[model samples]
Target: MINFPDDIFSEPADVDPDTLANLGPLTRLAGVWEGRKGVDLNPKADGPEQRDYLERIEMQPIDPQANGPQLFYGLHYHVHIVASDEDTTFHDQVGYWLWEPATGLIMQTLAIPRGQVALASGRASPDGSGLLVRADRGGPGYGICSTDFLEWAFRTDSYELDLRFNADGGWSYVSTTMLQVRGRDEPFRHVDKNTLTKVAEPRPNPSARIAAGKATLAQAHGFTTIGGGAGKGD
Candidate 1:
């Protein structure tokens, strides 16, 4: 297993919105959003099952993070999803959406409460509508890991997700996950798709807004910028 050194990280700072300009393709996705009429398709013993669900997501910009010379701008996100019929949760996820301005690297780290974790990576242009990212089972840098039960029953070979922004400022994603089921000789392609529309605008990063508000009040009272930036980060 790979281990991260504690010395690698510096003091955490409050998130800054001005740094969002460097996020490239991930910049637009930083904010609160909702997707209605999400449809998911999965492999069932009998056949394919389809279900409609609703999702509420909040993606907030974080301040720039650095690993020595490597820098990343990203969003910290939380997603809660519910289905029309079932009282239990349809899906729940927490992850980070990171963008490397220097290398055009995009990374998504996802963790579900159901003992599953995966990391997906890909590249995208700033103005491009379609973005594709990939992650595999045994990669050193970009890979997926699972618990013993999932690894034994449904081994995930690779995952690919494509996202496109429509004309109306909405976004849609098509996710394909290749799984090796224990009983099936052939690989099963599990697919899911959904189009999310903007239900509300995103709020400014917490620290940025708070600092800005304080500055505004101070300015009204005949004050000036402190010695320098607050240096707060997400």
Candidate 2:
């Protein structure tokens, strides 16, 4: 359990502005990536159904964040997947991957358009080659939540994601989700796995750019000063 400090409102001093330097095991994940030959398995009325897919993911560092005394370095990420045979989106997700350098704590917060969201947590060394995180059905922390209709039809019981950094500068991951489908006595295991290759490097975080003197304060805040007028990110 985490010990609470008496001065809960006090923020940490000397927080680093360079988010990439503090991301630890998640540093390698900051970039645009593409993966073909991905696989997914899901429950169907008759049985399980399997399909191949293509995926693209973008993970860019965000400015360091703090909540009172607690500090976090994180990445904002988006995932897009499509079936190999079609162009329509098969899956889409957006989330944040956060790490606490002081505690070696790793966390993943994800949301799907299908009205489900989850927070998963784990721990790993800064130089670890592999990582794992998990979330359960219901809890105050590290748990899952779903909409009413989803809860009645396809209840998600748990989720697990295992990651491995390859020797060739690539990465692979396997995600498994346990589901309790309506009118079914047995639970089902929905699984997806893929190996991704980097397609592009990530740009520096806003704070990092400011610290390096590469951007003005207004620009770092996602504003463009056009003849004294301002425009924010679109």
Error of 2 at 122 (Å): 0.7
RMSD of 1: 7.2
User: What is the Cα-based TM-score of model 1?
Assistant: 0.80
How do the residues 1-234 of candidate 2 rate in per-residue lDDT, one tens digit apiece? 888788878889988899988898899999999999899999988999999999999999999998888889999999999999998999999999999877888999999999999999987634688788999998777999999998999999999999999999999999999999999998999999999999999888988888898777787787777675644422
lDDT of 1 by residue, 73-174 (tens): 888899888886887899999999898766788999888887888899998846688678889999988888999998999899999989997888878899
The lDDT values for all models are: 0.77, 0.91
How does each model score on TM-score? 0.80, 0.94
| lDDT, residue 39, model 1 | 84
User: Candidate 1 regions off by >4 Å?
Assistant: 1-17, 125-127, 210-234
Q: Could you give the C-alpha RMSD of every candidate to the true structure, in order shown?
A: 7.2, 2.1
Q: Residue 136: error of model 1 in Å?
A: 0.4
User: Relative to the unseen true structure, what is the C-alpha lDDT of residue 22 in candidate 1, on a scale of 0 to 100?
Assistant: 59
lDDT of 2: 0.91
